[model samples]
Target chain A: MLRRFGLVCVFVSFATLPAHAESVRITQDIEARTITLNGAEIVIDRIQDSENRLEGDFARTSRPCPPFCITPMTVAPGVVTLGELEVMDFLDASVAAGEGLLLDSRLPEFFAKGTIPGAINLPFATLDPANPYRDEILKALGATLTGSDWDFSEARQLAIFCNGPWCDQAPLAIRYLLQSGYPAEKLSYYRGGMQVWLQLGLSTHTPSGG
Target chain B: MSATARVTTTLNAPPDYLGGNMFLASSRRLPEISMLRALAIASLFAGITVALVLFKADPGAPPAAEGANVTRSSAGFDNLAITPTAAVPQVAQSVPQAGPRIQDQGHVASLPAVAADVDLQAMTRGVLAELGVTPPAPPPTDTGADDPLHAMSMAALSGLRKMTGQPDPAQSPSAFQTLIAQALQAGQSDAYIDALLNEAAGSGRITVPSALVTAEGRVDTHVILSTIVAQAAIASGQDIGAAKVSSSGRIQPGQQQVYTVSAGDSLGSIALRFYGDMSRYNTIFDANRTVLSSPDSLRVGQRLVIPTI
Candidate 1:
């Protein structure tokens, strides 16, 4: 009798236990450029052609995931990896050739002092957000922008660098180029940035005024 | 009446009399009485057995053999007494043993557990001290004009020297001054020269400008002139020259690119669309300067000028 009673108690206890909680889901639509979370649409404002501060904010908050969590859908052209030594060689060759444009994404103060020889200062802050000139600039130089109009596509051979590996500016700049329509094959990311250049024996320039 | 009295007398007679009396009395009366007595005894025995079985069958019955007798000569007596005595001692010993034993067990269990709780702040402080981290003394508050341009110039010269594998160029102010004179003679922008100086200072290849030195060893120049020059150059790039007149004289890129203002759009949106970025929205304002007083006053439809890149 006691054994039978114990069996009944066990069954009752098992029947009364609670269930587990579920996780929330967030989704994005590339064609419509919309995002949905938990069955509700989310509207994102302040997205520009040059730099999307909204996207940057979104990337920062999407923790435990890649910083820029775009969907798997291939909407924009991909990025190119320029080997470290090749980038260094390019810088040396550019100086010798006096033909390449050294673009710095650092603050204006950093650029004013010494930068790569013949480099131009086009701070990320200056790019046109609404109708980004990444395409136009590349086009002016006889280059092509890669993907969609909203993307940042610039020339393939262009070398983009920021402060260093620790800096996200260059990556964002590269992303901007890829989105704008620059061919993935032509672009090279110089991961070793100004710090590396400065560490190595390289040229820099400063404007003359006080 | 005579017959009933005789029968009663016979029934009441002693067992010996019944056995020894007439044949009917001996055979029938005594035998029948004995049979009734046997039946009564059997019924009583059966009732006792039923009661015992019922009690044993009860679920709440006392444990079997709980008070069972043991042989007096057995070792049980000694065991019982010794067990109580031994138990008393164990209880006394357990009081002290429990505290330390439990504590030791807890210590053993928690030692590894507590290891991971190292205080990061304390660790950082210790490491910083080991690394010779000292608070930097506050900068001098009194100096001449803090022209960022001059700083840039110094920085550029220092950078140039470092690049060329030469010794620090700012070691001799005269050489630096001569170099500046030569660059200026060669028609370098004054802003460019200042930037070079600032860059030199930034790179730690030059001392603070002599102009910054004041009486009592205090330096106070805080003017960020380099920043101003950079801003001016950026502004110049943003400014639209003569509106590029295509053969049709229409705005080259178009009056406005179509845009669906998203949730985050503002007047800055329209301006950035028409202009290259937000900074050149002022140029759009200048183009429509007659109508829109501020860039903020823009609707989804309002056509605006996009300045040349």
Candidate 2:
């Protein structure tokens, strides 16, 4: 009976082995089709390979200067730069628990195409002090007005990114937000953004009504 | 192997009713003649059965089945069967017999009458009438455009006065000299005003004095020249759609200019300030297509390249 049981164990082990020997192995243990974000299941998967020969703008090798230049590593003093795994962790742990927000600071044109899951577009210019709509935007971000003074006690932590490290839209947004009294410790910068996210074969989804 | 060869082999080979024992043990023959007769009859039946099996198993049978579908009811198949050797020559003969001579005799004389019956103009007019669309009227010709002074009106002079921020007068100017005096009084240079008058005159507006039209070397002011540049742009057939006056009034014609987008700014408004026509915003959009994907969304502090048209 013991011998039979051993034989069955060997057979099961052989059966469970993968078909391809050279397939890549991921370091992170993320195997689920969707992840929890803000108490909802957000799907995480790479873009499918298109049959057509044409490529998209994010897939391009280069873009114009002034707007698409690479940014510095440190945006603010206490703000920490994040990678894909760290960003995902932020979304899964902080954002899902209602302690954080993910901001895609690109203009609506780029944001409308596709973005990282769980990201909301708050264009960089909207946070400018000179912007006429700054107060309205600040109010919408959960800032409360008390006797002509703004309070940021209940404001969630923000994770901002744009087209990638090369794009300044998000950095400008981070600077503006920092100037507007958002705590630097509460801001996480996803510097890799959509470019590196797509390069690494990560998933993205278009937001509703984007 | 060929179908005929396979059939022949099945006929000659002995059937295996008793397995290989029939051939091997045949030398130990049966003693009675009746036994030999029975064996001979059995062998004959077996040979016929084997032959039918071989024929069914033949590979060449499928092509014959396909040919059956093709010639199931051909018109000339029966006739071809009666004279098989002449079939190819007869088919070849039928083709050229329906040659060019037959086509010419049948079709040539009938084509011109068909062509003559079609009237393209009448057909087009009939189609137009059926659609209930009338032909557009011809544009009117103006013979008085050569006389620039004849087109002067108080309304145009008043419009110019309003553009320069001057109040409408109780009695507006009806002639070119009075209008020029009002423009000069509103802080416009003589040369700049003279250029605008020439542009208006060229567009069949009031004629200016010959001396003003021929004058040169007047002092240039950035403020006055830029305003005249904008106004002359409109008179020179540009549609300067509602654009606010720029804070820095400098005209940089035929040169590259960079404009930072401000709040509530659009390609139309920007084009109106620089090129003096909202429709020419495409010039800005085309120049900035490398950075901007659409002309509708302009971010604040986004610098756009403006190419002069």
Instruction: Give the number of the best model, judged by TM-score.
Output: 2
Q: What lDDT is reached at residue B268 by model 2?
A: 50
Q: What TM-scores does chain A show, candidate by candidate in order?
A: 0.48, 0.80
Per residue, candidate 2 scores C-alpha lDDT tens digits across A1-210 of: 999999999998787665333222223355334568535688665434333232577677678776678788888899999988888888877777767778888766677789988887677766766542354455555565442356788777888999888888888888998888877888878999988888766678876555
Task: Tell me how far the alpha carbon of residue B16 in candidate 1 is from the true structure, in angstroms, after superposition.
Answer: 99
User: Which stretch of 10 consecutive residues in model 2 chain B shows the poorest summed lDDT?
Assistant: B211-220
Q: Which residue pairs in candidate 2 have backbone atoms (N, alpha carbon, C) closer than 3 angstroms, thus clashing?
A: A38-A96
Model 2 chain A — which ten-residue stretch has the worst lDDT?
A19-28
Using all chains and alpha carbons, the TM-scores for the candidates as numbered come to: 0.26, 0.36
lDDT of 1 by residue, B1-309 (tens): 322332333334323232222223223323433333334334434443554566578856433222111111222121111111112222222211122211111111111111111111122222222222321111111122223322332343343333323343223223233334333233332223333433343343434322221111111111111111112222223111111111122233323433332221233323323331222333454456455443333333345444443
Alpha carbon RMSD to native, model 1: 48.6
